[model samples]
Target chain A: MTSLLALGILLLTAFLLLVVALLTRNSTPRFREIPALTRLVRTLGLSVEDGKRLHISLGHGSLLDERGGSAFAGLAALRIITEKTSVSDMPSVASAGDPALGLLTQDTMQAGYQAAGVEELYVPTTSRVTGLTPFSYAAGAMHIASNENVSTNIMIGHFGPEAGLLADISDRDYVTLIGASDNLAGQSVLYASTQDALIGEELFATGAYLGAGTSHSASLTVQDILRWLIIITLLGGAAAKFVGVI
Target chain B: MRVLTAVIAIAVGLMVLLGYFFAEFVGIQTLLLNWAVILAGVASLVGIFNLIAVHTDKVRRAEKGGVYSALLVIALVATFVFGLILQPQHQIMQVLLNGIILPVEATLMGLLTITLLYAAIRLLRRRADVMSVFFIITAVLIFLGSATLPTGDVPVIGTLIRPWVSQIWALGGARGILIGVALGTLVTGLRVLFGIDRPYGGK
Candidate 1:
């Protein structure tokens, strides 16, 4: 019964948000400042101007897991970045820990080039399967960061404390690092190491923030509405409890 | 093709999701999830092949790291043949996992600790914020608290700060982060299920 109620609430909220988004087409929703994303745009521009490659690591997250949400968000960011860089001579490269993710990364890169009408510039070797395990993935990604002359490192997905190692590697190479991760340890490491680190749900906002489309925006809107509802519920419940009410 | 992919995705996603709530289609849900796992395993093999092809191309082009690529190929082939000859759970496999893999991973983990320490120092240098200072202090407290003193007793300062910092403060922050992540996951899953967003290279 609880799951049913939860599902009902979610579906209704999503539908209402979608309708509102469609009806309010004339007006645009304003988002607060996201420093990481702003910095990423500048870095991408710099990479293109300097003729240096952009390196993206999707981390060691499996696409089939429940926690794969962060990886999906990472992929959305990849799509947006790849599209932007597809027209440039220094195309962005992507690495993934999962084979399924690697294949999807390849597909996303191809789609980007296809959309840009620059399929010839698409290199099949750019999107690589770095490693299957978390630490190994970090080691492989570090190897690329040090050897590939990557100007910017955008690391996002399900990472652990190993993220610190990647950031260290990037720091050693003096490469700009933009990162996001769902792992708590990874978040701590990112906070300590990276200046522009996307924390928690901020990672989920990549698609909407990067202007993937209205669906992403609508979904983000629904998430915000639900969050507000949750806050109200928590506060009201606390008040009720304080007043000796159930 | 996009339309077909979307249709199939929605059908499969809804079926499996519905099966979780209603017990009648549990078998179907299990079957679907199993199929996904099996496909993932196959995709892993394909990824290995893809890696081989990529390295082969690098070796052919005589890239800067062509020697390393060649070495990787050699190691991969040797490992694969060895694993095939002596079953995966054999003593040799155990030796490889325990002796080689574990040691390498442990070394990386050790490096992670040093890297984290360096990063914390860098954080202090770069930001110099109260939060960074607090983070460093909490980390130091935790490390000291978890360590055994030469006199065989936990230090009083470490003991006093560790529980408050780790069990209460860190746990509360972690729970908040987890709640946010759970909500984000819900939204992401809903988008995929309802076809609001598709990352399968469709549309």
Candidate 2:
């Protein structure tokens, strides 16, 4: 015990930086434009205009795993979509492989409804568990994508290569595919299949980019600060090693 | 009410995070995590029941896809009954799990190859960006490199270039992505612990 010194320090630093960012930030943090996400919101608006359904899949990620972070980011994305769709009764459906994540997705939808003052519009069936495993999850989600009158399909979570099938479904049905995944294999697949693919850490910036609130933006700012710190540390270490300082 | 929810989240989250550093707190942290896991198992049952209810309603209403829903219910019942009677370790259970489920999963995986090809072909058509070009070129190189020649392994092309390209270039890119994902995951978890993000909805 007490051996995870690095982990403890990193966690503590992240916590402190997040607090400082939240307290000092007067306005929402501005993120560099991500075309796919920007287009995703626009496509969501179009779905509302066209009176079509929008489907979101949280993938086969569980909260008990390291991939939970991506799923949480997926929930943040659900919040963004539901918040917009709640205003106009644009039907939105959320599916997840894990029931626990499904429950969170449902809760996020409810919060969105609350934020939009449209609690009555929230439907339990809107966020449901589609499947338990990765391939099965993709298959179930693809069925919905193919059969349902979905205008847009946005998946941001912990998907594997199985996501390629869902992307194919999007393509076959002419549904707009906007996706992000934490898994490297899934990202590669998405790079090929999706119209807009958020690569790597871009998935985590969904909340900040969507302008959820200042707190969301603050979290992103903290991430950026830490990323710079890590980059500098890596460079310094390499320089020191090259000079044989040790 | 929201404040209470946030406070609870912060306390539980802090406990779990701190449990890594403090052995004395690990028991309480593990207890909470176990409770969550148990709750999740129960929630899964609820999800299954909810699915049944939804499809049952559709069948009752004779909706457009009611027949499909009815079929799904019938299949689910059949599987559940068989599993219950035979138990998971029985021959019939293995047949269903390994024989049927595994093949279906394998077929889906196979389909992904074609889908990836279709996507790669359409990639440049959709976005003619520099990255897209790089991606297509890298994919082509890797695809060609990984292929074994009929004459046997080509010296520089297969053995040297392929391994270097994959091991150095591709692995490097993959490693970078993993690092970025790790950093993102750390911050995202911290956001939840700090109560900046309220995914459970109350705060």
Candidate 3:
């Protein structure tokens, strides 16, 4: 019965997302400014123009688990970043801690290149698995961030407190670091370590904020609607409990 | 090709999702999941080879960190060969794990404490905003609360405030973030299922 209820909710969310996506097909939606993403997008353009590399770290999040959600968002951001910077002297590189994520990142880069009509520029080594363990992953990504002439480091995925190491390198090397994570430890570590850190649901908003597609924006609208619904339900439940109703 | 890939993905995804609620599709879902697990193992091997190839190229080109790359490749290959020969359950493998891997990882974990402190200090120096101040204050209080002096715990901060802050405020905020994250996950999964957003090489 609980599983049924979960499925019902999932179906309802899917319906809402599709409806909102179709409704907003012709209309342009305005999103409130997220300074982190703004700075990231701006840095992306500058990095391309200046012939500096960009490093995206997709942490070791399993594709079969809930953690895969944030990593998928990171992949979407990577696609957009790759497409935009494919023509630059130094193309963007991505690192993943999980094998599935590593392969997917490579595929995403290839798709992005194909989309930009630069399939010849696609390099399989551009996206790879740096390390399997959390600390090792951070260490390897730190090497790339510090040594690859990368101007900006965008870390959006599942990470642990070990992310502080990468952020430390970014700070020491004077490279821009924009990071986010789904894990609480990772979030707290990133929040304290990085100057531009996306908190909570902001990590999921990467695709929408980066102009991935209208469907991405529509997903944001669905998230907003669902958030309000959840808030109302929680408040109502609390009120009922306060009034001696179970 | 993209359409076909999307169809297969969506069909498999729906079957797995439905298998959770209905018993009829559970067999197929399990079969698919097992296949995925096998594929993931192969992918890991592919990733390891890719890592070796990248480092090999670096060493060949004599890049600045080529020495480190060479060391890594040597260590990785040696480890793999030794593990395969002796088996992971062998005493030598256990000693290698306990003496080397575990200690190294533990040391890194210990390093996180200092890194976190340094970051907290840098955060204060970089941004003294309301959120940063609150974060630092809460962290300090939590640390202090968790510690005990020669005599006992601290005064009201430890006795009265810590439990409330951790159990109430922190729990509430974490729950809020979790809900938002769940909603985001749901929408993202839906997008993939509907073929609206494909990160799996689909155009």
Which candidate tops lDDT?
A: 3
lDDT per residue (tens digit) for residues A1-246 in model 3: 788778788888988988998999898889999889999889878987888999999999999889989888888888898998898899898999999999999989998898999999987888979998998888789889988898999999999899999988999999999998988899999999887688888988999888887899999999999999888988999999999898
**TM-score of every model versus the real structure:** 0.95, 0.94, 0.98
RMSD of each: 1.9, 2.1, 1.1
lDDT of 2 by residue, A1-246 (tens): 246766765766677665767686785465688988899868867877888889998998899889899999899889888988876555698899998888788889999888888888888877878778899788878877876688889999999999999998888888998999999999999988876789999998887777777766776667677778778988899999999995
Worst 10 residues of 3 chain A by lDDT: A1-10
First chain TM-score for all predictions: 0.94, 0.93, 0.98
Candidate 3: regions farther than 4 A off: none
Candidate 2 lDDT over residue span B1-203, tens digit each: 88888899899988887787778889999999999899999988877876787678778988767888898889888898998898989998898889989999899888888888988999999888999999998888777777878987776767787789889998988887887898788877877877877888433
| Fnat per candidate | 0.55, 0.69, 0.77
Give the per-residue lDDT digits (tens) of candidate 1, residues A44-145.
667777888889999988877765888888887888888888876667889888999888888888877777777788898889897889997888788778
Give the whole-model CA lDDT for all candidates, comma-separated. 0.83, 0.84, 0.89
DockQ-best of 1 and 3: 3
- Model 2 / residue A171 / CA error / Å: 0.8
- In angstroms, the error of model 1 at A30 is 1.8
